[model samples]
Target: MTLVTDPTAPRIAIVGATGAVGNTLIELIEQRGLRYRDIQLVASARSAGTELSVDGVAYPVHAVEEFDFAGVDLAFFSAGTEASEQWVPRATAAGAVVIDNTIAFRMDPDTPLVVPQVNAHLLDARPRSGVIANPNCSTIPLVRLLDGVERRYGVRQAVVSTYQAASGLGHPGVEELREASRATLDHPEEVYPGKEFSPSLAFNVIPKIDRFLDSGFTLEEQKMLQESRKILGLPHLDVTTTCVRVPVVNGHSEAVWIETQGVVDRAELVELLAALPEVTVHDRRSPHEFPTPATIDDPYRVHVGRVRVNPNNPRAFWLWLVADNLTIGAALNAVQIAEELIARGTL
Candidate 1:
């Protein structure tokens, strides 16, 4: 697909427009003051005939099977893996560059898995297969910081534990959390019963995010290790992860520990991390302040804090990280890739 060099006018379509990530994409478009000649909203049959208003302008949502993709220069897809597998080729064939937010093509060998700030250069290949993938939400914020570290001191091993928000499952996940919360309030001592999340997600944390594999790691956990390596170009990096589903409604947080190749100092590390434009360092010793998922206000930046150098291993360090799973981790990254394509005249 070819995009007009004119920044003011590029035809764009957002698939799964009524979904949480789709809504977040619309919000970011308005917030970033982006201009487009046309913006189309496409979704499933049930969402057809519905209207979604962005920046005071309402765009009618159409079913994907019925929507024409010919004029679309760029398409942002947040639909499930099944839908992506079916429609992405059609969209690309219709001359639309697809930025898919599903696991469908992430490890496709040909399709580039991109987090714009971390690996925007990968998009330079323009998906010889005609599709680019947005990495898993949990992997997005993690890799952004790791990129900086890998560029400087060379990371050798890492461990990550995630506290994923209810919103990770989309609108249904958020609603389920709300229902569970209400039920828990009614019966203070009773465990809330819900199938959407195994065990109750209210007043409790689920140690598992996705289904467990034969290797004992959940799919969500495996994605973190695999996607991190691909994004950082470290095919054999030692990485392990434990993904948990927390009751929070908005942001996803993680605790990360890393061992670099060389000795490092806390002060120097913080200075280097702070210099990354997409990362916000909230570390401070005196006031006992740090970043938490709930305390983050801006949805675009990843918040990092609690920088600690391992006393036993000076080459190792630990930190806390947080980001909006729907925005920066999903929609914003897709949009940024589109913008990067435009900047590099690849769209």
Candidate 2:
């Protein structure tokens, strides 16, 4: 966060600097040691006068309207879809490359929807569009493993059910769940009248996330399907998901059923998955070996367990995975994309 005079390193800006993902992005930048000439912290006008520190040096939050993007060589956006739609173009037009964590431009023909683990080759050159889209929280971890399976075993179909955390909605959702849970515990007969999510997320689970589309799938579910195809470069890939909002607080977990084109040996499959970069696999039968959201030791890595190939169908298998939605699913991915861009001199 210190102002450096290195001309080769990009001068960076973080839009949505006050939000949860924005905070996580800041943490990762310090942890990963991404080189930057200087940094700008931007947020809504309401948060403008506040200050946030990066690398222990405090930086004042600038209102998006007042911040100039001209000198910012790299800009990271996590300020929801509407904000990205409104401000991203202005940032890009000012010669800043955007690493966007929104649905705004993921499907744009010009913007590349990226999950660096699977298709980082797309970042070898500057994108034709001034922006790069980060995949959905759940889509990211799923595609990371699916890419490995598809290359070695040839994935014919992948059916996943995501048990997403409250943090997927960011801080407000987490606060609502906590207050509602406390309220429920205090008075079991009273309804909390929570506003963050429909029904309630206290001691309960919702099968739907985002708005329900005409196709009957919620927008969250649809993003998983469409984003996977685009990120994996599989136009017609058969990947289906049921996105559920669980009572947990931060990590996202998925139960995947993948049917491959050929038979797969369980041992080979476990070896294959563990070989993936930054992936941890628990193939042991011991009950304590599997990973849970609270049990994940490394927030930066993808955790997979219960790797069982169907005995009746050797070509089909079941696996469970847990990942920090904030890190692997959002902030870390964006930072990794920036790292790749910097290393490749694409920024």
Query: How would you encode candidate 1's per-residue C-alpha lDDT over 1-347 as one tens digit per residue?
Result: 12225655678899999999999888888877656778899999999999998778778999998889998988999978889999999999998889999988888888899988887888775788788899999999888888888888899988999999999999989999999999999988887778788787987899998789999999988888888888888899888999999999989999999999989888889988888877888874432568888788677899888888999999999999999999878998888888888777687
Q: Residue by residue across 1-347, what tens digits does model 2's lDDT show?
A: 43568899999999999999999999999988888989999999999989998999989999998889999999999999999999999999999999999999999999999888899999988888899999999999999999999999998999999999999999999999999999999999998897987889999999999999998989999999999999989999998889999999999999999999999999889889999999999774442478999999999999999888899999999999999999999999999999999888898
Evaluated with TM-score, which candidate comes out highest? Answer: 2
> For every model shown, what is its TM-score relative to the native structure?
0.95, 0.98
Which 10 consecutive positions of candidate 2 have the poorest summed lDDT?
281-290
Clash pairs of candidate 2? none
